[model samples]
Target: MRIYLVTPRNPESFWTYDRILPSLGKRCIFPNLSMPTVAGMTPRDHEIVLCDENVEEIDFDVEADIIGVTGYIVHKPRMLEIIAEFRRRGRFVVVGGPYASLCPEDLRGTCNVLFVDEAEETWPQFLADFARGAPQAEYRPAEKPDLTTSPTPRFDLLKVDQYHAMTIQFARGCPFNCEFCDIIVVYGRRPRVKGVPQVMAEIEECHRLGATQVFLVDDNFIGNKKLAKELLRTIATWSEAHGHPMYFNTEVSLNVAQDDELLELLRAARFTTIFIGIESPRKASLQETKKTQNMRGNLVDNVRKIQSYGIQVQAGMIVGFDADDESIFEEQLRFIQDARIPVSMTGMLQAMPKTPLHERMAKEGRLIAESVGDQFVFSNILPKAMSRIELYKGYRKLIAELYEFRNFRTRTLEFILNRGRQVGEGLAIRREELRLAARVLRDTVLSTSPRRAWFTLSLLGATLMKRPAAIADALAFAIVHKALYEYMQSLDHHLERVIGEIEAATETMTAAAVNA
Candidate 1:
């Protein structure tokens, strides 16, 4: 059998790091772990090829027995187009991943085979059936497969040099159920993780492939604390033994601040970054969205505590909610600045399919359209407190204020000053990272834009003076801020057009009602 695994292209957004990738000499941030893992699932006798559309163009004419496409909601439009192109070329097409798994009905007529939930068990079944000349239109597991037996991803298939980081998964599912989150719906709440040896092997594989930065890509790294500690301890030991060839990062709930031991294990394992969903500071919004974990403690203090352990906290914040009003935007902005989180990814609240929020919105007849996963530009649900136009305008204003040159610099500097010290191994910067840093510095120094040049140079000086050991990290933050500021600037025209259309439509309806 011949297989071609494809990951669709993502639109230019903060996560894409589109602007900075050029300076860093990378195609994308990282490859999605799904494709490589799926490649690993194929039989050894079969030929497998993998391509990330973000990094390379897809050849519709490729000679392959079957085409497998996977992506999140952000890539749905591109995924559909890719699948249609392949099927139009008379190739078998299969669709899966977060978007398909959450809303398979949306993909029903578009592809020959659709996979839902975990694919470890269903992928092999589909392969066997296809070989026998009879394949199911859809494959969904009756129960979640054991991750302990999951196969190591075929990282060899990926163009490692093109990516800035490598991706691996240590676990799936989250213990907490945030109403808008799709993880719990897809993976269940009982965190399932791979064996320690399996995880170490994946790490070793990544290291052997010249990957210095690896993302764990877990739904919540500490969802199961006991298991997570066990894994972290093993990782700490193995990383020390291997001279910390790869520094790790992952996502976790903010409740991790309460666990000092887990924080120690993470620092000991040389995990340099952790993304936490500090969705909102408003207690009402938190309760409305069922993200009570964030409300358990002082959000600002928790973030600082995490940073105190020398782990950079990249935050995820949302604005739209039933409990949010016009004032919520300022609240979010103030909270982000107060938290001193350098990379605060704020987006409009989206009612993703299969989540509790989506169901409630549907029941209330508030779902306006399917969410496209670009939170800055789109929101599917009609808010209870503000009109759609108002929501969009407020969100745009909030983003502008948050990423404004002065504010961005202040927060970034504060973070660096408070980022604390690295307590464990892996302190030395790798040769590749130094090269990236030099490139970043050179680009910023040569930049024609005054705001960008000042932002990087100013941050560079402060980091050099206060935390010289973190000069590379400071440069990385400056690059990300540059990407985000440029991305927002690119969206201005499109956003204004969308808002104008909505406002015009609203006025038309209002005038018609008055005339009647």
Candidate 2:
């Protein structure tokens, strides 16, 4: 049977930066790794075509026996649309990935089949059954498959020119169980890592395809320290021998700061940045959320320690825990600013379906009376102590303060001065830094608006004259923030629409109750 794997397009959100990214000559940051992975899992006899709507237009008229759509919670609406479009054409549509895996009921009417959980164990069987003209309504893996057997994803199917980086996964799952996180629920707590040779082979494939930067799309890359160290050591040797063609990035727990050898290995492997989930600064909040691993040391100091190894930190922070009150937003912002974390991906707490937090909320009668799709569109649930409006206002204020040019520039400079001293190790590295600085300077000085040009120049002058070491760091921060600011503006508009819809729904419910 012919198969077309689909990744649906995301409606631009407050956090979308596509519009302003042209100024920096960057496209979207990361490509879809899941759909391609599913494509890789298909048996050799079956013909497979992959289309990521983010990079390609969907051809509804394209003839295929089966359509496979995969996405996460945020992309549910688009996934539903894709399924409906295919089903309307009398084609069999399979829905899977995090959203469908967590709650298959939401996809019942739209999808002819639901392949939940990891695809490796179930996908081959699903294809075999479909080829026999017997497609089941649902398919799930009986057990998690070993990562070593997973194929190098079908990167050939991607439009490499349309993205800033290609993604590869070395590992799955996390060791720590943060309450709000869905990683453990989805992949389990015992970390599973691909063998070093398997990972290196994938990297070699990406290199052969001219991918200069690869994101290791692991929830916690170093969660298994011994295995991770082994892989990094091999990667370091391979990268050095091959002229270090690719720079790596991945997410990890903050405990990475405790291991000096691991940090050295990561730097040697050309790993430049890490996304750490430093959820909150308040120790009580951390404990409340069961993120006790982060409470092991001074939070800011741990972050600085990682930065000392020349790895930039892009952290995730959330407000609205049971222990949190109104002051949480300001405190969170101050902590982020004080740490000089350039990319602070702050969001209101979301009790995702099937998460421990969600179960507890449902038990306590705190789960918002709305569908999972609605929650994805807006911050639907609220903390027990705070009103919904207060939470929304607080989120807005925090984002506004964090992205303001003056505050962003100041914090970035401070972070650079603190971390830049550790990065001046060799001539080659220095040359790369200078090249990036030059490009950033050109982009900033030649901005579209005169006011933007003046602001960019002023910020550039401040970094170069006041703290020369900070120029590279400041440039990186500016590129990310410029895109983030544009995305946040879009998000604000989305939030307003979501609020209006919620109000209308509430009014309709009230009127129906009165009539009854």
Candidate 3:
């Protein structure tokens, strides 16, 4: 069968350097990991063509016996549109991925077959069943397959030139079950890791394919600390033998600070950055969400210790929580500043489908009377203590304050100053640092709005002339913040549409009631 595997285009968000990524010369961030994995799952004899719209355009007229698309919550609308288009052309459409697996009802009658959970254990069976003209309404894994059996992703199907970095998964699942997180629900609590040899082999393949940076897209890369350390040690040796061609990045728990040996291994392997989920600093909120990792010690100090090894930390922060009151916004912003975290992914708490929080909200009658599709565009569910409007307003205020060109620049400079000093750096090291610094300044200046040009100019002058050390620390901060600013702006537009729809629906309901 001629199969067309696709990663749908996200109409609401597009890769634009002018919006969020000023420092990156590349057009897009990363290829969609799931579609490629699904392609790998297909039988070898079947002819398959993969198209990731992030890297290339989709040819709607392409002939195929089957059309497969995968995505997460944010890309639901686009995924549905692709399925609808294929169905309109009278083609068999298979929908799967985190979103579809969690909310099968979203594609109820549109998709011919829905594959839930990991496809590694069930996709081959699905292929055989489909080829025999016995397609089932739903396909589910009887058990999560062992990681050792999973094959390397079909990276050759990707447009290597379009993405900033390549991705590889070393582990599946996370140990922590934070109330707002869907990782445990999807992948389970007991972490499953790929063998050390298997992981290195994948890294070697990425190197062969010209990937300079590899993102370990695991929910928690170090969920299995012993395995992670072993892998990093092996990767360090590989880097030594291969002339250090690629740098690594991944997400991990805050407890990474407790292990000096692990940090050293990561540094030796050229692990440049790590994303830590420091959800919130408020101990009450942390306990409420079951994220005890942040409550162990000084969260800011733990991050600073990681940064001391020259591994940059990108922290994730969420604003809405049951325990949080209106003051949470200021608290979160202050926490970001106090921690001196360069890049922060701040979003309002969203209760994704099939999660513990989602079920609890539904049970409490707190879930807004809206469809799953509506939840993706905006924060549909409200917190127990706060009104929907308050949450919306707080989120907007925090985003505007953080992304304000002047405030961002000033905070970045302060973070740099806080990073004491680096002694005994060679000319080569200094030159590379200077280049990164220059790129950050240029990106920040170009990406900000015209109204903030004055602040940008002032920052550029201070960074280049007055504070050389500050430039080094602020570079990564500016790159991520610029991207986030553009993303928030897009969200603002989306929120407006959602609000308009709500108002229209409310007015219609009121009129109908009056007439009755």
Quantify all predictions' global Cα lDDT against the true fold: 0.89, 0.78, 0.76
TM-scores, in order shown? 0.97, 0.90, 0.87
List clashing residue pairs in candidate 2.
Answer: 14-487, 14-490, 14-491
Question: Which of the two, 2 or 3, has more lDDT?
Answer: 2
Residue-by-residue lDDT tens digits, candidate 1, 209-327: 98988999998999889988998999888888877676789999999999999999999888889999989999999998889998877999999999999899999999888889999
Candidate 3 per-residue C-alpha lDDT over 92-199 given as tens digits, one digit per residue, 9 for 90 to 100? 889888887777787778889998889997788888888899989898888877998888888887777667789999999998889878889889998999999988
Prediction-by-prediction clash tally? 0, 3, 1
Candidate 1 Cα deviation (angstroms), residue 265: 0.9
Ordered from best to worst lDDT, the candidate numbers read 1, 2, 3
Worst 10 residues of 1 by lDDT: 421-430
Per-model root-mean-square deviation over C-alphas:
1.5, 3.5, 4.0
Checking candidate 1 for backbone clashes, the offending pairs are none
The best candidate by lDDT is 1
User: Candidate 3 regions off by >4 Å?
Assistant: 11-23, 369-377, 414-476, 490-516
Order the candidates by TM-score, highest first — what do you get? 1, 2, 3
